[model samples]
Target: MLVRTGGPLAAVDPSEFTRTMARVPTPVTVVTTVDAAGRPWGFTASSFSSLSMDPPLVLVCPAKTASCHPAFVAADRFLVNVLSATQSDIAGRFARSGQDKFGDGDMVPSEEGLPGLAGAVARIACTLREVLDGGDHSILVGHVTSASVSGLDPLVYHDRRFTRPEPTPSLTTAG
Candidate 1:
């Protein structure tokens, strides 16, 4: 447990803080976009979440240092591909720097012209709704124009490794 003393939070080193934060499990997702020349580009991200239901907004954060960051920022639209446990390899491919991540035979084009990875649990197509200029990373808020789900289990990340969730109560209970 993380115990908090009465005084100011003890100064922890950056590596320690990063490793500590990595302990929190996060759902894996692939953020895909088109570059200036209309070529496909994308990267894997764990920083994604639904923001609003009525407006159907979603959020994703891409690191400033990411090679595909410019492509995503420049694109008018993008797709958030939620990967399943079987897609850990896909996520790893996109996470690498300076490589033709999509060269693998797993990605396909979506109806909306964005690249969609095969066997993804869910794909959310969105237009760039907003961009918040955060330090070291940019927070992208998207308006979900279209979406689809495969109804499969989602892949997860924790402590710099891939993980899968244990079976839980289903939305439809046994009758």
Candidate 2:
């Protein structure tokens, strides 16, 4: 049996870890929320996924060093916009720091009053459930309150590039 300890795990180079993980395809998203003063804040993230169904939960990880981290940490609610295949520009812009992220992404106010990408393939508006500490990011667990889907192709990130999935022909047996 393997041993479990309270000590830190073996170290691995962050660059290598990132490069390895980049091989996996992930949906690109821009998570948005409002600050205490009602100012909009958001960040692009690929580390998001559905966590549960019974209570309808989703989680997104925002880097702790991100400029918008504090605002998200303090937000009571937030919106997660799953970018459409054509919205790679929005993903690129939101990933940077100290730039106009919402300038040309066709962002509009969501019904919940949060900044929302109008071209999202899906939109999930959630109430803050909990925030847990991940290695270099905060894992924000959200309780989904409302959601919408457009049935559009989603922007996918793979091998450090943005791409979309191409549908494969299905095989069916004739009766």
Highest TM-score among the candidates is held by which one? 2
Q: What's the CA RMSD for each of the models?
A: 4.9, 2.7
- Using lDDT as the measure, the top candidate is 2
Please write out the lDDT profile of model 2 over residues 54-111, one tens digit for every residue: 9999999999999999998889999999999999989999999998787874889994
What would the per-residue lDDT of candidate 1 be over residues 4-49, giving only the tens digit for each residue? 7687866889898898989999999999998768788888999999
> Once all C-alphas are superposed, what RMSD does model 1 give against the true structure?
4.9
Model 2 misplaced stretches (Cα beyond 4 Å): 1-13, 171-175
- Structure candidate 2, residue pairs in collision: none
TM-score of decoy 1: 0.87
Model 1, residue 95: distance off in Å is 0.4
The true-versus-predicted C-alpha distance at residue 135 of model 1, in Å, is: 1.8
Model 2 has an lDDT value of: 0.93
